[model samples]
Target: MQKIKIKGQDYQLPIYLPDATLGVARNLDSLDLLQVGLEGVMVNTYHLIQKPGEEILQKVGGIKKLMNWSGFVSSDSGGFQLFSLIQKNPELGKITDEGIVLYTGPKKQKKTLFTPEDSIRMQFALGSDVMICLDDFSPPKANEKRIRESVERTIAWAKRAKVEFEKQLQKHGFTDDNRPLLLAPIQGHNSHKWREFCSQELQKIGFDIYGLGGWPLDEQGKFDYSFCQKNAELTPKDSLRFALGVGTPENIVKLFFMGYQFFDCVLPTRDARHQRLYVFKVDPKNLNQEILKKLTEENRLQEIFDYTYIGKGKFATDNSAISQFCDCTLCKKTDDIAQVSKAYLHHLFKIEDGSAFRLASLHNLRTYTLLIEALRRA
Candidate 1:
């Protein structure tokens, strides 16, 4: 599998699955909907282990064979979920020198322990092309002391994950011909100083890539464009720089200009489910008079397309319009929003329809894939 190099950063472009179970259930066919040139897929380590379990994946000949996906695949350490669990049920998590232990699942039925080493070992079993290290995440608004503590823990975990990965490679007799790469994550909520420090430290450990700028940038507005710009500049040039959990088209455009080479997030697909389509062009010139009037006058257009309240009455259409314009197969074959109407999508939100969720998800995934192609050209 060839690694991608952009502006000196090396990465295997990832097609991310926000949830492993959903990804597996959707199966390999869903990948056909990706834009023509997508490079890889990403799955969650936590969700896979909880639902299908690592053993099932291994028996099915690893993630690649199970999904029948030929391209590269990467798995995230369950660190983010651990953070979420701590917030929701503080009593369910225990932080130790080894790692954090958590009680997971419905009815809190199962107990799973996730140490840095454990994260690496599970990823090894799943046979991902690249695996991320477990890192501590601090909220963007966290006090300086807490941020520092989280940064230190993240560094510690990076070192541990590296040591464990190296040992695994040696045991498996993995030469450069066949060795899985590990991606070290940079932590430090909104503090530029801490972010730089974390990057510098992780560079010394020497992982294949870096997962830059975690959930903080999303949760809080503290780290702006300049923060991402500086962090991308400071990161090692040879390793991949992936801005995790950032997929907004506008944000991606800004980050691409800042030298970021890779990214993964659920926003595109998640937002698509809500009937929000992302079009690159600036606000349509005749939005109010022409588009709105057409929509109001025609029953179908009014039924399918309408002015968006979110973007100051910008013309918004269901997945069908955006999909039809897109080159992806989902749009080409289905021809009209995969048999679901815009009104149905809107109703899905009002009544919560699972079918609408699937349709919207497919559209969003295609939209993101298309956006990446556009960025690559630029």
Candidate 2:
């Protein structure tokens, strides 16, 4: 897919959406995101509902208005977060065919049910351009029976979500040409049998986008490109595919060629906060799809990605910019003016200053966006 049209706006495909999970991209504001070339962000419905609540969001005119951003916004169903909570602490909630039932209180007895309809309603209130359907997240180390159960629940919930999505389109006066796009995730852990089954069933029901659900990892805990490739093949060539929560720069490049056009990941921003910065070993401006494809064919794409640890002792006295090639505020080279110095970043992190976080985040986000720019050209 070259581009995806949602709510009358067209976003260039093979794009990377930074995880602005709570309406903000951590230390960076909307302006900062724009400066880094990010045209879209992914927010979590569960957290926003809990914090600002849906009523406040509606009154404030959704997240875009709340954040003063005009870029594309996609809202995750928050099923992943709920699943994570229950998996970490079974007392928090339980997932059933009806929906997720939460028990939150001092003694874990306060009941609250979150259904597919509830997810759809919340997305509408949030005014998300792209809304995700609530799916049963495949837990780690799940057996065949557990995987099959997750797939079944995912399919059932998707059917409910589709019905509710239609209800929302009508309630919000969204016409067929202006309606928000809804995506359904296919879940089956790593089982091809159930993955195929889930995909076929969801295709019959239909959706604007299909997400590669569950973890994209193998038994040995390595990135499973084979699984992602297989999932891409399960869908039609013209269909839009979202590789949810995926992954490193290399992962993005590989998956893009595999026909996955949309991706959301926390690696760049999250890694930046931890003082880890991504740098292109080769200047990205000098590269394009043909070069990248050649590199991939030669198994040399890994050479393009490198890292700089600002917190390392060696960087304490290094006066060079974080990256010589980056155009972010932290590393832009204009004549002889250096935007930011490695030594200064080291000092800021050493002193635990807040500016260190913002500067580092800007640089990392720019790196991801630069990679996306190259992918777009490809």
Candidate 3:
């Protein structure tokens, strides 16, 4: 699965998709995304349906036409967002066997039923290249009884989602080879027994891809690599694994080795807007799959990746580009008079200019794409 053809477009695998949750990446356009070597993006079905609404997207011929983006697009089923909302305040919604019941209006009286079938239908309307099925997320601190309930509900929802996916495929006239890929997440938190059960059942039901669902963090909020490693092993050797909402550069490197091929995260773009910039610690030219593989094998990730706080006072006087290895718009500026140097970028942020967000985002995204390029070559 080194290369994938989606919506008649070809893209390399082990790819990274920035969160363009609402058809647009913040402060950047479609061309801006393409220029930085982004092959695709992960959009949120929950947000798009609220803002522009479904009718407009269908009328405009989907999100691609509305944004004029020809790149690959993956749509999330909004399970996690709904889960987060409900977890924070129980009054907002509740996850039922039938569907998700969202409470709205001034007093939270209005109710809307969002089922797994509805998720697939909305994804069809969005014209997504990859569609994720809605799954009940296993809470991190759940006991056995709660974890079991989540696993049961997740499988039930996936069964319903599969039925709807087939219906949408026939209705939309998509054939086997040309149809969008469907992915189902494996739930049950960190419980190996339930997680393995969830994996086997989902495999029996079948899906084009399997997702690493649930929070991949510990009580201390650090990444739990053992949990991720076990999840990948639970799936079949040939399955295309998608690590949803995962993570920094080192996390990506480690997971890629564990057999995951797809990833979507808000870190790079979100970090960019927050003035955190990723930079290769070593010479970019020396970087290759073999080199990266060796580093991971030896657990030398810190030697391979690092980031700089561009908002720091020291960078305000630095004359260098954000990253010498970067070929982004801000990094590759040739003319001396208009060079997008660290000093210039610092000034933009200091002045609170809008361009600062776009410029910083370009550099960070290019950093991720560069890493993806190295991984694909292996």
Q: What tens digits encode model 2's per-residue C-alpha lDDT throughout 58-160?
A: 9998999999999999999999999999999888999999999999889987999999999999999889988999999988699999999999999999999
lDDT of each: 0.64, 0.91, 0.91
Candidate 3 Cα errors over 4 Å, as ranges: 333-338
lDDT accuracy of residue 205 in candidate 3: 96
After superposition, the stretches of candidate 2 with alpha carbons farther than 4 Å from their true spots are: none
Q: Provide TM-scores for the models.
A: 0.77, 0.98, 0.97
- For candidate 3, lDDT tens digit of each residue in 1-378? 377776567878898999999988888899999998998999999889997999998999999998899888999999999999999999999999999999999999999999999999999999999999999999999999999999999999999999999999999999887899999999999899999999999999999999999999988879999999999999889889999999899999999999998999999889988889999876655677888889999999798788988899997888888877777788775764336888888889889999989998988999998888888765
Cand. 3 TM to true fold: 0.97
Candidate 2: clashing pairs of residues: none
TM-score attained by model 1: 0.77
Full candidate order by lDDT, most accurate first: 2, 3, 1
- Clash totals in order: 1, 0, 0
RMSD for all candidates, in order, please. 8.1, 1.0, 1.3
